[model samples]
Every structure is written in C-alpha cells, then in structure tokens.
Target: MSDTPCRVAVCWLLPELEQPARDLAARLQLPVATADSIEAELLLRLGGDGLSLQATGADAPGAVRVDFVEGALAHRRQFGGGAGQMVAKAVGLRGAVRPTVLDATAGLGRDAFVLASLGCEVTLIERQPIIAALLEDGLQRAREAGGEVAEIAERMTLIQGDAITFMAQWAAAAPQVIHLDPMFPHREKSALVKKEMRLFRPLAGDDLDAPALLAAAWALASHRVAVKRPRKAPSIDGPPPSAQLSGQSSRYDIYGKKKLG
Candidate 1:
C-alpha cells in the first residue's frame, strides 16, 4: 500500500504545536506553515483523513509505555541517564529488555512508538492492510520531519503481516520484550469512546486469539513478555502476572520467564 500525501493547512494552535507540527510535516514530507485559522479540532478532523496531527496534550516524543489514560507520557532523554521504572525495566538486564522488540499486534503503532521512544529498536507487525498503510504513512511523515523523535521513528520499523507467522521467523535476535496490545472487545457505547480510539476500533478488530498470541510471545521473548489488558479482565488464560502496572481501567502485565537481575 502507498503512503498518504501531506496536506497544508492553517493551524490555530501554531505557537504550541509549532515544533511537533513542523516535525509532523517534515515526517510527512510536507511544507510547514504558521496558519492562524487552524484549530486543534480542525487538525483532528483532518487527521481522520490519514494525517497524524500534532497538538497540545498529545503524547510527547520518546515516551515509553503509554497507558491510554496516562494521557501522554514519554522518556525525558533519548539515551541513558536513567529515568522511570518503565524505561529502566525496558532497558534492564544489560539492555536485554531493550533489544529489538517485536510489537506482534501493532494496531496503530502507538505502543511501538512508545517502545522506540524508549530506545528499544522496534518492529511493528500489523495484520490489517489499511491500518498498516496508515501507520506507514504516519511513520514516513515523521521521518520527513527530520527531528530527533522523527529520527527515532526511523528506527521503528513497520511490517504488514500476520504477527503469528512473523514471530516464528524472527529467530536471529529474539525480542526480549514481545510487547502485545491486542484489540479487545469494547462494551461501552460508541459515543463514549475517544475519537482516536473509536477510529482505531473498526480498523483493528478484537484479537480473539489473544491467548495464542501470548503463548507465541512467551515462546519468542528472551526475558519477559509484556501485555496490556483491560483492568477489569482476568489475565490471559487465567494465569496471574508476575508483576503489573495498573492505571484507571487498564494494566500492563509482565509475564516473567527468565529472572531479571
């Protein structure tokens, strides 16, 4: 699939969105501008048309392990100097966890972006052609931006294929953390869902075979397999996590296979 073309428009949130906007534009290979009439809402409207919008309160560059509710969290520095636990856990074991991570179920490259932001070389494996195409376009746009994060985005690769098949072939360097964020069924009303999340739901349906994916990830990961699950739900296959990071309605479960020193 081909990437979408970048479009030029006036952004009202220019002063606040300047750098990110420029970076987004550069990544999309479009010309940057300071249009005063464009509002964040307008950008969001246009972003629906396959453009990655940069605006206030959106996640920062290099944010590791973003929770849907954490708003937008990113790592402060690119390399070293040590920051948070998420970053540390991701980089611990002599960078074992930080080794190339295979986002087996890379829906829209959100989690993959976080992992890459945290310095872990990441490969996003998305099955849906359209979603993968959108991710590819967004990534290409980020690359064109030519900023620090844009450069990091370059390190994050996207592949259109079934993760189950890809994971089996990725043997040379097994991912220490096979990050998985499978699409689960949402019971709430559509109007209640966030605009971004709503857009993603249809493009990426619930991965009903989540248990199998977990099993596969467990087999492929060298040290640990991290999974994101809805807070109300039980662990995949009914086994509890060795450790979990909880937020409002979701959790990051760590299924430890090899002991971490």
Candidate 2:
C-alpha cells in the first residue's frame, strides 16, 4: 500500500450539511474547514448534492464521488447489456443463479452496484476511511432517492474495514464468489487519466499486498475468486488462475476450487 499521508479535510459547503460534515470530521479525526480556510489539497465536501471527493490543486482533475442513483450508473443500468457486461460475467452471473459476492476492494462501488442491480447479494469492503465515508454518503443518498436505487442499496452491505481480516473471520460462511480489483499500478498520467484513479492513487497506493489478499480470498471463496487487472498486466504471484477472460483494457483472472453450477 502507498504510504502517502491523507492530505484532506472535511469541508461543509452548505448550511444544512454542516452538522453532518462536522460529525464526519469527528469520526474520521480530520479537522473541519471551509474551501477558503482549508489547507489540505483535497476536501471531503458535504454540499447541496452530496459528499464528493474534491481535488483542490490548480491543475487537479474534477471532484469524484460515488453516485449510484443517476448519471453513469443509471445509463449503464438502462443501456448497458445486463448479464453480458464483463464484470457480471466474471462473477458468474450468466445463469439462473445470482451468486452472492464479496467485493473485497470495492473502491467506488461501480462494479458492485452493477452486480447488485443484476440481483446479487453483495458485501462491499473498503479499507480507506475517506472512500468508505464517500461510499456511505452515496449509499445514503441512493437509499433516500427511494426507487430502483433503494432496492439495489438494500442488496449491498458495506463494511469499512480490511478485506483479509473479514475473509478470515467469515471463512466458514464465505460468499459464493469473491471479486477483487486491487489497485493496479497505472500508466503515466495524461488527459485521459481515469479521474477516480488519479485521485485514489495517492490515498491508497499500489496494491503491493495484492498477492496476500488474493490468497486469503482464495482460501475462503466458496465458489470462486474473480480478480480484475490491467489487460496486459501479469497476475500477482499466486496459484495460477483456472481461467482468464481478457478485454481491451482489462482482464479477469478467475480462480475456483469448484465450478459454479
């Protein structure tokens, strides 16, 4: 994991969210500040819309946050092929059964939400406190939106903790499929850089511990462990994957003790 310090604070951008912002600050042990008064380079902003992770440097990319209610997620749900999506197929969502999934490194929850929308009981584990806070805010917003979004949120359980520990503790009752997308080392920054990746790289560095994490998931996953990686990137050191499905930009290294029926 990257050893970078969190250069961020909780900022309340609206009067109504001030208390929630302050409460979040206290929970995160981060000082509360305003856009004008804050010294941190990034802000966990509580605004009229919802909580957003704001990049504050002169040339920084735009703010990034989880929004499963509308926007890209909605478009994906409406237009994107249902069980034919790469992630959906990777987690064995093709047949009649929608396997229970544990998304161990659920950074922004995009894939997990898709799985949940496709009818999987998904447990999301995020280790970073700030990211977890953002996810919680988004989930709360989606739940209150009260429609299909709320129903999807009902199928997702968020755990703000380490995936390995949780896997070990819940080994006997492991989910059918464990999905992992540990932070892969990225290419050089460019105009097309994934905004979320750029913002998250500093907070949660390269997944140097990815191999260990894969081992834990492999030990506990009842059906299989699906690992997402850069298409050309070599698999992290582990028992060789039973199969791999490659796409233009990414690949799924699938490991399983027994095949899902």
**Evaluated with lDDT, which candidate comes out highest?**
2
- For model 1, residues 1-261, the per-residue Cα lDDT tens digits are 112222223232434555655665454444444444433321321232233433233442221112221234233343334425453353242543356677887766766765676667888888865456457766776676676657678778788888887877775788767888777667764333455554444445567778888888888888888888777767788366788877677777888877654
lDDT (Cα atoms) of all candidates against the true structure? 0.60, 0.88
**How high a TM-score does candidate 2 get?**
0.95
lDDT of 2 by residue, 158-216 (tens): 99988888887883467999999998776574333878877888898888889989999
Candidate 1: clashing pairs of residues: 12-38, 26-144, 26-145, 27-141, 27-142, 27-144, 27-145, 28-141, 63-74, 63-75
Q: Which residues of candidate 1, in runs, are more than 4 Å off?
A: 1-97, 189-192
Estimated TM-score for each candidate: 0.64, 0.95
Model 2: lDDT equals: 0.88
In candidate 2, position 36 carries an lDDT of 65
